[model samples]
Target: MIIRTAMAQINTTVGDLEGNKKIILSSIDSARSAGAGILLFPELTITGYPPEDLLLHTGFLRDNIRVLKEVEAYTTGSDTMVVVGFVDFSLEIYNAAAIIQNGEIKGVYRKMNLPNYSVFDERRYFTPGSRPLIIMSGSLKIGVNICEDIWVPAGPTNDQAIAGANLILNLSASPFTSTKNLTRMSLLQTRAMEYSCCMLYCNHVGGQDELVFDGRSTAIMPDGHRIVARSFEEDFLVIDIDTDQSTRYNLLEGKRKGYCKKAEVEEINVIIPQRKHQEFLPEETYRVSSEEDDLIDSLVLGLRDYTKKNGFKKVVLGLSGGMDSSLVAALAVKALGKENVIGVMMPSRITSDESKKDAVELAKNLGIETFEIPIESVFDSINGLMRPVFSDRTHDVTEENFQARIRGIILMGLSNKFGWLVLATGNKSEMATGYATLYGDMAGGLAILKDLYKTQIYRIAKRINEQTGTEIIPRNVFLKAPTAELREGQKDQDSLPPYEILDGILRLYIEESFSLDEIVSKGFDRETVEYVLRLLQRSEYKRKQGAPGIKVSKRAFGKDWRMPITNKYRD
Candidate 1:
């Protein structure tokens, strides 16, 4: 028998219940028109994923339930079976998927495995479910599970298969990291083959706060044949799966012996209307995006959704003509239109002639406005006033930081007067080593490149130029050494190690979680590793106050890496 399944990979904003409901209803209509018998949505489609503390509010849960009812009402006169994720409250809340057929609730599958590590605290909000839910549609025994339920090898999927489930529907809100999509696909294919069942994986897409979900949803046949949806965007994927394929690999009867008591499957029977069998199109594999391309897309979408969702139309950033600021400006143009981005060249006395020219050239190439604001007078006044407090101390980092603060004030001033959001351009290398000033370069409403390393920044800059087919980011910008221009002849390498070395050390320490000895063992100088570690530990406060950024890496400074500000444990 052939069954048509619709994977509704959609983008959802957190706490927008009515808007989310409207999108769901519209997707339902679209899926029904496409003649899909089973319609599946992402995890927590009603309230949005990681609703966080919003789940604590009683009214939020009630409103979600009301919205689910409204969605159930949509299926009243139709034969489409809607399986959508929402909050189900009994004595406590559950991350659940409600199965609806012909205006009636068939079953609710509470997510059994609540993820608690690294940007997930689902256990804090939800109680663990003990039983597996299987819904019988005609001859098809379809098992329902949430995001984390399918991750475990011996979890609900195994139990459901033992209880005569031939197909599993997994609704997920899995966030996008560099290698996460590939890893997720591998796991899904393995589960489908091992359980001898076709698996439908529907994932959330779009940006919500720091998390960006790339909806590369999939349908894996029992024989490991698969079809994938589009990445980093919403897609309605309708495909036909052969139900007879599961009969070839039955679960051993003894496999159900120990699980008989705790793994009793709750079964619900619904009459699946037999519709005309359309020709099943050949399943197409999604084109895999390069890591650099994926990073660029994630940043662009994250910035776009953050600004538009927060009610900001335009964004402003200081353009030093350096690699960091130039990349941020280009991204802003990509996220918002060129007209919506403003590049302010806040040049100090030490600013290079080339820097000023490059800034103008980049703005022109990008078709954005540029403002040259010379801060010499502001610097002179602040320096004179601070000379007395310094007691004739030689010009040091203090004076250098004053220059950055002056530029910060200018950017913030423009932000206030014109209602533009300020975008900080500091990369992960600087943020890791406390290379940014607290109220100076770090002062912004959002940090666009906070999670990208300095080396990765240059790679993306080159990729942008390559894709645009023109020198949008000036050629000189790539040739010039990266500098803050806070002092005369200032270069980033003068204060910190070379970016190649520094970023390598940082990747091991921050992303890889390598200790000082392990990092030093990897051919890095011991002293350099120790110094980088020291700086990273000391910079916790600055990162804590820094603006939120898009997370494209496995671990970002935002919610994933939680280090104490006062911790003294050094390795």
Candidate 2:
């Protein structure tokens, strides 16, 4: 028997029930026209994944069920079997996949495993399901499960296969980390090989607040042949598989008799017309994206969705002619389009001529609007006003921060005037060590590069220039000594250590969770490591007040890493 399956990797917005339903109905029509008998969508297709606190509202749940019924009605009179993720409520709520065929509800499979680690908090909202669900299409038995259910060793996948299921369908809304794609692919391949059944995985693509879902959905055959969809974008993948090859493993199925509970399984039978002499097309395999490519696309999508979904048509940011702000400008142009981005250069007396020139040139290169707002007069006025209160306190970091605050005021004023969202340009290295001034450079609706380190910032800038095949970001910006330019001849290294050493130490301390002794053993200076650690510990209050940014690492400063602002414990 041959079965054609379509994996709909779509982008969904949280709490947009009507919009999400429209997308689902449209995808079903597309799948049916492609001659696919079975169609699969990502987790929570009706209401979008991680609806978060919205799931707690009774009105939201009712609207979600209402939209699911609308989708089911749309699937009426079609031969295609639609499998979608939505919230199913009885005495309690459950993360569920509804099976619909010919206008009737077949069976709903509740997700057995509710993930509660890191970014996931499903257990707080959902009750774990105990029984497995199997739906039969002709002689082929296909099992359905949700995202976290397949990750367990002896979870629903094993039990479903043991109970004579030849295929498994997984619906997921897995978030993107730097190395998560590789790990996820390896796990899926292992499961396919272990169960000796064909597997289809569909994932959601788009950005939700701080989380980004890269929709690299995949189809794995029983013989270990894998086909992947696109990354960081929506894709409709259709593939034909041989069910006879998968059923041949039934001879070895008896080994799982003791482990399986056949009585607890809910089975539903449906008619599937066989296609004889059907032409099988070659599978398309997607190449894994490089770190730079993945980061750029992830940030672009995150920024695009955040701006558009929040009802903003334009974005504004300070163009400091430094690598961080320059990169932010380039990303803004890419995300919101050149016409929608505004670059404001706020130059003070201490700012370099080269910096101002580079800022103008970079804005011109990006085709974005530029405005020059010199702050020398404002700086002098603020100094004069504070002289009497300061008495004899000499110039220091406070004066430097005053310049930043002035620039912040100008950007925020422009934002208020034109209704454009401000994008902060501080990178992880600055935010980690409290080098950023709160309510100054940190003032914005969104932090574009909050999770990227200084070293990574330079690397991405170089990559952007290379990919664009032009010096969109000025080359001198890379070669020049990194600076805040708040004072004369000021460089980042004046206060912080070298970026190479600083980024390495931070990766170990922040992302890897390494101890001071362990990090020192890695050939870093003990004093430098301790100093950086102290700075990181003291900066919690600042980060807590900063705007949310995209998370591209294993441990982002946002929701993933929650530290108290007033902690005295030392590591």
Candidate 3:
């Protein structure tokens, strides 16, 4: 008999029980209509994944349990066995999964492993379960584990397989990083092969704060082969599994479980009258599948979710007609609607005519609103104020910083009056070398492009325009030599090395966490490396003050990265 399973890749918000319940019920109904015998959900699909500090509140945990009971009551008459993740409050709190068959909960599986390091903090909230849970269906014996359980080589799945489990279900809320799906598939396939059991792995999808869960749920045969895989986005995947003639089913173990349960306890035995058997052909189990879209989809989704969920109706950008700000404005328009984005052209005396003209043309091409705010007056006012303080010294970078501060205060005023979220457009190169002015251009409700390198920003911008068949980002921005335009002849190359050279070293030193001597030994000039390293070290405080952006890469300036501002040890 072929047992059909549906994996629901549902996106949930933390603490939104009513909404989560509606979604869960809808998915179960969908799966049932699709002829699925059982439906699987991700870890904490009810209260959402990584409820974080909310788990610390006792009332919150109580509410989670309350919803779980309500959901169990809602499913009493349904034939579909729905497996869902929740927080259970018994004598102690448990990260749990309830197996609901025909509207009543048959069994529950609490998560055994609690990840405490990196982005996970499950150990801080609840006590780990001591054992694996195996539920006895009419014909199929299913074992269950939570997110971090089967990722290990010697976890509960192994023990459950030893105890004669024919199939294993794993629920998770694994967040996306670089090449995470590849690693996940490898590990899950390894576990399936090692345990010789049909494995079903499900993960939640969507963005919650800085975290973006990539929902690539799948069902695998025992021989480390994929039966079917779910899509990355919100998907409802159903696959047929023939337990009797399935490739992964162990006949000896299935017969052994039919006779006994444990060493001492009585086996869970049920008497069902036999029905007439019909000749059967093996169901078609497809091989491994792949959905490889361009890398831009993830960046676009991450940006879109982060902006919309945060409740920002409109975004304001400081477009100097420069590469960074222009790319940012284009991305903002792409993420949010073009009408929702405003590009402000703030020009001082030092701003070139091409910069002003390009800004206007770019705004026109994108069909976004634009405003010209001349900062020459503000610069003159600030300079007049600081003239007496620096009576003897010639005009310097501090003078140029005044122009940026004026623009920042103006943006803040607009933000205050219009309730628009400001998107800071500083790139990783500028942010790394303290080349940016804190509380100046750095003041914003969100920093959309902070983590991206200068070269990467240019690349994504060009690719966007090329793909769209329109110049969303004008070509002039890319062609022009990058400049802060703070002074008359100030250029980026004059202050720092070219982005091609700088970001290359930065990729190894910052992102890869290479040591100073190690970076210097990679054929870079030692003095330049030392200077850039020092600048990066000193600019942690600047990064701390910048607005939080979507973490597209492995590490952004948000929660994923942590750097000390005051440190004594230096190379």
Candidate 4:
């Protein structure tokens, strides 16, 4: 009864069947090499967790179940038993676990509980499964649950326990938001102690938009000691259990179902050599990084995945001599290798010599491709087209924005021709305050650092240089005060408050969802706080149109940060 179990807590992209299958196979091989008999994967590991609207596509479900079968085939002829998650659609869709042994599909268990609260909308996509599976893996009577199934007291596990299950395994794609681990650990202990069975919990790892599955996957003994545990940011867990340990203690009984069916004490214990036990190795607990480090790491991870997933070998970004573009160019070099990132410096009439020099030096230092595209002639032609109709007003923000749009259009044209996904570099500070020119800097498929504030952007830049120890970003870029350079000496601070104050207020207001009065009461000047609040309140529509930015914080301006744009409620 020396049962060996492994947890492959991996990071998966939504709808990435091929990529996920590859990663899963690698983990399975690793597990087999480690002499593990049973390996557990996260919920929806095949088609990725929370496939969202993709579940609406009939073809997607058809394909996902097909992939699960192929995965099942790969596990053939090996002594290892795999219990991985995927969507199963017969008459209806189900959050399911496909248990495979020797290349044959043994038993499939549909998740009994579908959590439909907050971030989860599984009830919308999947029909509730009725039963828990307790399959035979050597001497272990292994009961299987998915996510929320074990969190509840009475459910499929009760039936399985009644049917004689000595061990319960739960698979999850549980998200991290403050204090989630504490809650999970508390419930796991309660479940193991109450059920009088060893519990194995496996979860997904890494960032998926705002939802980062902290894969602190654990295995609790019947006596409530966490015997096996793995940490966040992806890893595998291996647990060794003495199955006969259950026979060493008395069995406790709970009702078979929600109803008062007669309780039965069911215990199945097979003998094992009680010689040695594998000690649990605990990984260092992760502390949240500074805001800038968080944002930078998020962008790097997002860019790496987006490019790698899309089958792009190189990244081509338009780097202005300005902060936004400079930040993006540097990040691209980091994400993709420096050789794979190409930077284009497009200068208009407003471009400074310092800006041009800085851009060139940045590309040179990073060893990336840098090309200059001056658009003075393009602007002159566009101005000639508009002059006949607009004779009265002198040039303003519109004229400045026309240059930006031309840059954007040209950059996209290059991206189209060269197969580069243009990375827009508008920070959250600009996006929230509407400092970005529509169809101008906003013209890109992915926004590399959009969720970051301007201050956070600088911090990230500084941190990058600190890590690299070379002159990647020009020193002047860091030393000089911030400006969009839209017009003659137009600065960001001229329009918006100081980034220190602005980002501070924004974090409390946007991420924390603080009211205006409450934010003002946090020892900030009332008028500035009110103005910033009003700006944030009004610019929801613009943010909705911003590029797909990497989510680093608990509340990014993505699906996780939904608000009504037409709402009249304000302070």
Candidate 5:
């Protein structure tokens, strides 16, 4: 009556079928060696999570099925029942999981709920599945469902449970967003207690472009005891659960809930051969990571994967001695090693001595190579070239932007000559309000802090220093006024409100989706709120052109925010 289950919390690249196949096969062998009765893999194990437009290709779909078949062959003669996710195209494409045992696919459970909110766009590609699946393995009746299915009420889990399922297995590719892991575990615990069954959840780990999946795959027993895998990394978790200990039969008195009739559920029977396996006590412990730890780890993983997956071994960033650039440098060093990170100081006449010293000190502390490419001569040449057309025009924001563009050209030039990936240091607040000069400071392959607000950037910067046990980010960088140094004595607060106030309004307007009046009502000045919203609306075009960055918030600018550039209506 005891069942051993294993979950492979693995990292997969989108569209890398051959590579994913190797990982999946190795995981299957490991799970079989562990003597697991059932093994679960993350959703979209073949094609990787959120394959996006690649799913539209007919050949890709066939190739995914081919990989699944290949994996199925590896499970031949093994007692472990493998449930791995893949794309299924019967009449139409469906997000599905194949149940394989003894080299044969017992059943395929198509994901019933296709999420279409925020970062998820599954409904656009996948047709909704109607049938709820249950696997009858000896005395254990386990319900199988995909990510969104378990999140929604009255979904496949409920139907399968009503039809006498005592254990629920979920294969997920849920992306990291601040404290989503805690919320996910709480949901699983609630479901386990409600159904008087154990909830086994497996999630994808590592970064895919902007999305970083924290693979804290977990199991919640009916008694609320929890067992978890590694956080923000690949981990193989194996655990045992006694079917006799489940309270489902006692709660239902050996009768079905009748909410879903026996005929309504599609059942597959698999006979797992009883074998002598080593018994180990389940580690009923979950690693509870703080928001700071999760944030830093998510950023590092996202940056590392993005760089390596894109075929870039080294990264270069313009070090302005500001908080944003310094943090990005530290992250790049951590992700790609200090030898691969090159910090360039493109100082102009307006750049402060303190800024120059701060940038050098930071590079030294991080043990990174530094280059001081002063842009004064380049700025003069650009001005001389422009003075003919602008002989009568007065010096204004145009001159300030010229300096920024000159520095941008320098960074891009270094990137081209040395083949270094340029990292943009602009944060969410600057990206939101039109505070960044287009084609200037925003010129990079990836924007490290694109989705983070200015205040959040400061907090993260402080936390990095604390975690490293040294001032790698430089102590003076934290106290100095945040400035682009585009002009003499140009502080960010001069153009915009204080970060504390600006971030407060932005959190309400952007993330919380509050109206101008609504934000103003929440202890903010009406004029300031209106101005900030207007700036945000004006900056839509710039954000659309910027590089994609890690999404660690409830709503990021890339996939989540979809504002129009030619809109006339004002909030």
Candidate 6:
């Protein structure tokens, strides 16, 4: 027997019930047209992943179930069994997958593991299931599970396999990180080999707030061969799996592992007739993307989805010709196109001629709309008004930050008048150390590089120029020393350490959670480590008020780093 399975890696909007219904129905039609015996979709396909507090509403849950029933009605007379994710409201709500066939729900599989770690609060909304589910279609025994169910070593997948399941179907909304796909693939392959079954993994695609899901939905064969879908984009993949191969491997493996006669699990038998083997072209394994490519793609998708979903067609950013803003401008153009990106150069008296030249050069190269707003007169006017209050104080960081706040005001004014979303340019290095001024550069609707360190910004910039085969970001932007140019002859290194060293210590402390002494043991200066750690803690309040940004790293500041603003513990 041959089972033709279709995995729809889809992009869904939270609380968009009608929109999600259309997508799910359209995908079901496409799958049925391809003669797939079974179809799989990503987790939370009806309501979207991480619906957050929206789940608290009773009407939202009822509406989601209504959409699921509509889907069930649409699948009437079709032999294809659809496994779709939705919120099930029994006595209590559950993160669930409903197995629909022949116009009625055959069975429902509630998620066993509720992940409550970084970016996930499933435990708050869902009741974990204690029973494992297996679907029986003729000789094929398939296991159905949700995301995070198969991640554990001894999760429900173990029970389903012991019950003689030859195929495992997992629906996921796994968020994109730089190195997460590699880890996910390895885990899937290990499960396939150990269980003597093919693993079908479907993940959501597109950005929801700061979380972007890279939909690399894959089919891992029992022999460890994989057929993958697209990355950072929605894709529909259909593949034929030979049951003979799986059955043979399962027989040997199950007997070797001393398979039990009565496995503790629930079984739902559905009559899904096997479709005739349609010889389609073999699917090639997706090419391994370079780290630069992954980072660029994730950022572009995140920005594009956020802007579009939020109903903004244009984006505005302050371009200072420095690395952070310049790189952000380039990415904005890539995501929203040159016509929709507005580059505003709000130069004050201290702004250098070289900086002005670099900013203009970048705008011209990228062909984005440019606005040269000189803020010196405005700065002087504000300074004169504050001269009496500042009579006791001399020139210091206060005067320097006045310029940044002025530029921020201009950008916000443009955004307000033109309905353009302001994209904050501050990266993780500045955000981590509280180097950015509140209501100043940190003022925006979205922060593009909040999860990325300063050194990582330079690397991405280099990669952009290298791939485009042109100096799109300008050569001088890379050559010039980093600076805010708020005062005369100022460089970032004057206040903060070199990015190479600062970023190294930050990675250890923030991502690795290394203590001060442990970080110092990694060859960093003790004083510098202590200073960086202190700045990180001191800046927690600032980060709480900053714009939400895309998360492309293992640990982002939002939702991932949860430190109290008034904590007194010093490391």
**Top-lDDT candidate index:** 6
Candidate 5's displacement at residue 567, Å, is 0.5
For residues 1-571, write the lDDT of model 6, one tens digit per residue: 6789899999999889899999999999999899888999999999998899888999999999999999999999999999999999878899999999979999999999999998899999889987999999888899999999999767888888888788899999999999888899889989888878778999999999999999999998777789999998889999888766677876666632864444588999998767576464256686788888899999999999999989999999998989899899999988989999999999887889999999999999999999999999998988899999989788788878888899889999999999999999999999999999999999999998999999999999999999889999989999989988988998999989999999999999888888999999999999999888888999999999999999998899998888989999999
lDDT of 2: 0.90
TM-score of 6: 0.98
- Which stretches of candidate 6 lie above 4 Å from their native place? 251-263
lDDT of 4: 0.76
- Taking all chains together, each candidate's TM-score versus the true structure is 0.97, 0.97, 0.88, 0.82, 0.97, 0.98
Overall local distance difference test of candidate 6: 0.91
Which candidate leads in TM-score?
6
Give the TM-score (vs. native) of candidate 5.
Answer: 0.97
Each model's lDDT comes to: 0.88, 0.90, 0.76, 0.76, 0.88, 0.91
Report the poorest 10 consecutive residues by lDDT, candidate 3. 264-273
Candidate that beats the other on TM-score, 5 or 6, i.e. the better one: 6
Which tens-of-lDDT digit does each residue in 1-571 have in candidate 4? 6677789989898888998999999998998888787889999999887799899999998889888888888987687878899888888989998887778777788887888766678888999986566676455577888998887777766666666567788888877644456677888878776666777889887656445565778877666677444444578877677665554432344312344453333332222122255553334333434545545655666677677766777776777666777888888877788888878888876777887887888778788877888888999999899998889879988889898899889888988898877788888888777878778888887886777788777877888888788767889888877877777777788989999999999888877878888888898899999888788878888788777876655566776677888989877
Which pairs of residues collide in candidate 5? none
Q: Over the stretch 259-334, how does candidate 5's per-residue lDDT look in tens digits?
A: 5444488889998644344374466778787787788899999999999988899999998888999999988887
Q: In candidate 3, what are the lDDT values of residues 1-571, reduced to their tens digit?
A: 4667778888888888888999998997897677677789999988998888888788888888788888788767667778899988767788889887765777777788898755777888888987777766666667788989998666777667766666788998887765666778888777776666778888898877766777778777765567444444688777666555332345533423443244211123212122234222224343333222323555555666666767778889888988888777777776788989988888988999989988988888889998989988878887888889889899887888888888898888888999888888887778888889998888887776676788888777888787789887788887889998998878899989888888877878867778888888888888888888888888889888887765555556667667788876787
Q: Candidate 2 — which pairs collide?
A: none
lDDT of 1 by residue, 506-547 (tens): 999888888899999999999998888889999999999998
